[model samples]
Target chain A: MKELDPLLHSQLRLAIVSLLLTVEEADFVWLKEKTEATSGNLSVQLDKLSEAGYISVRKEIVGKKPRTTCSLTPKGRDALNEYVRTLKEYLHI
Target chain B: MKTDELTEKESIELISRMIEKTRNEMNGDDFNSFLAYGYAAVAISIAVWLLTHFTGNDMWCFGWFAMFIPYLLSFFKKGKPEVVTYMDRMMDSVWKVIGSMFGISLLIIVVAGAISGIIDFSMMMPLSIIYAGIGTSITGLIINEKWFVWTPLAGLAAAIWMLTCGWTGGSYDNSWNLLFAASFLIYMVLPAHIVRHKISRS
Candidate 1:
């Protein structure tokens, strides 16, 4: 049986990635709102995903405010697809 | 649910929940911006009709320019959405094209009138109503909003009905103005209001 990607097996990281799958990109505030993650925790989690090359993070100044946006990379998407396949396999169809 | 880690079943479930949540959020984006334009289209059509019919002055038909009011209001709408979904981008791009087409059609009318100097605007209203209907119906299909599909179809049908049966005389007939207004009312205003009401209730 295939194994789930450890990076995506966690609840919050999986939630963040799952949300990004349906969108082109999402910003920090939006993700925080949807995931109900604390700013500090969300930032740390996002850093891990970015470090893994599973997601891309961009920071820019918009209207005198710092804005951070995240999008799932193609690598991340493939990992997600693989994770779901593994889950399905473990369940035996 | 736990903040981290999940069983196999839980992982699957969480993914499903997040996807569903994103879809719901797409629907939850306020349709008020669209509704503003829809109602404006209906209102301007009627006002143009009334003014032309009563004053016997075709120049009053230019009142349709007031559509810029809602267009500008929506253009300057403040703040960014928390998340911009694929659906959001798609819908925004679609409407931008439709609005551009509407503008291009106006350019056609203006250029045609400028060369001739008569400025007969009889075709502009009905054509624009059809464009609105197309945009509304397409959006309904993309978002799976049933009323959005049906209402615009009804509007398109009304527009066709008017084109064939509603017109009484020639090119300058005043009835076109009223028909233009009524079709937009059916195509855009009615469905928008209905969907918004349902969204609010739910």
Candidate 2:
């Protein structure tokens, strides 16, 4: 069995990647709403994903407000797919 | 649900839940563009039918130009997408392709009218309905829109019936316009009720 990536083994980060995989890109606010995560926690997890180069984060100002958006990088997608494959193997389904 | 740690089974469940949640967000403006184009097309189809049926003049068929109403209205329909889903782009592309087809069909009708001094949209009408069906069917599949999965097949059946009537001598003088009117009711307005139900519940 392939070992899961430690970086994505946590709950919030994996949830973020899963959401990003489904969307083209997601703003920070939307991610918070979906994950029901505190702003502080979501931001920290997002930073970890960004540092892993698993997801790309873009910050810009819109209407005098800072807006942060996240999208899965190609590496992120590969990691997620491999993770699922490994889980399937473990589940023996 | 957000959390710090998870077992393998829990991770799998998290992925499933997150994907499902995002799919729900695929609503993307409650399908504003679809409803806008659908309603406009239905209204215009009825208008063309009314004008042609009552006037008994081919010139009245010019109301087909009114189908462009949705294209113009698109600029005014506003909804900001917070998270852009892949379906949003696919939905946009499907309508764009159908709009181009509508443009090409209009060009053909205009050229034909200019040459003959009368617009006879015999085949064009059915073709337009077929195009409408294609757009909705693609959209329905992308968004998990239930009505779309089957409505397009119904619309296609209607269009084919129109073609059969038009090709043979069985169709009335301009009653296909009324047939168009009825088909648009199915193609466009029916989805409105479904959307309305969702909005009220939500």
Candidate 3:
């Protein structure tokens, strides 16, 4: 059996990536709320994904507040699809 | 959901749950803008019709100027979430195109009527009603809302009724305005309120 992508195998990181798949983009607050993750923890996972080139994060000022928007990169999409494919294969379904 | 290692079934389940949750969030929007515009459109149409009837002056058509209130109010509102989904962007684009079509069509009809000196300005109402039906129906289709789909049909029927009455009675201004008012109320306002109520409940 082939090994899973360790970077995407974690629960929170996988959930974040999964959520991004359905939308054009999501802000930090939305991600935090949906994942029910603490701001600090979500920030850390986002950074790790950013470093791995799985997602792109943009910081901009909307009104007076700094807004952080995250989108799933093409690489990230391909990884997710491939992960699902491999997992399906493992399950023999 | 934090886990050191997920089995194959668990991974599939997690992915499915995440996708489902995200989709629900994307669709979970209150129809604030729709409700505002629907109510305003209904009110303006009826008010203009009543003023025209009571005053016996054609100038009451200018009451349509009030319809801009709800349209412009939408811009000043800040309820839009920072995050937008694919469906959100698509719905926004749909409404924008529909709005532009109405603006351009109205401008063309008015300009043609004025320059040719042969077209009746009152004729614009039926055409506008038809366009409203088309727009509402298209929106209904895009959103998968059957109520919206039927609204356009009802609007078109009202427009047809207005045309028939004008042909038979020689003057159908009141009927035209009344039908439009009813259409806006039934297809736009009522459905918007129902959708908003459902959104709140969900």
In candidate 3, what are the lDDT values of residues B1-202, reduced to their tens digit? 4535777787788888889988787666676666777777778778888888888986787777677788777677774475778878887887788778778877887789889885455666676677766777777777788887887778788778777767887664664667787888888878878777777787
Per residue, candidate 2 scores C-alpha lDDT tens digits across A7-62 of 88889999999999989899999999999899999999999999989999999887
Order by TM-score, highest first = 1, 3, 2
**A1-93 per-residue lDDT for model 1 (tens digits):** 667899999999999999999988889998898888899889999999999999999998877789999999999999999999999998877
Candidate maximizing DockQ: 1
Ranking by lDDT: 1, 3, 2
Sort candidate 1 into its docking category.
medium
Candidate topping TM-score: 1
Residue pairs with backbone atoms closer than 3 Å in model 3 (clashes): none
Candidate 2 clash figure, as a count: 0
Give me the chain B TM-score of candidate 2.
Answer: 0.75
Show model 1 residue runs off by greater than 4 Å. Answer: B1-4, B116-118, B161-169
The CAPRI-style docking tier of model 2 reads medium
After superposition, the stretches of candidate 2 with alpha carbons farther than 4 Å from their true spots are A1-4, A38-44, A58-68, A84-93, B1-13, B26-34, B51-57, B108-123, B141-146, B161-173, B191-202
Worst-scoring 10-residue span by lDDT in model 2 chain A:
A60-69
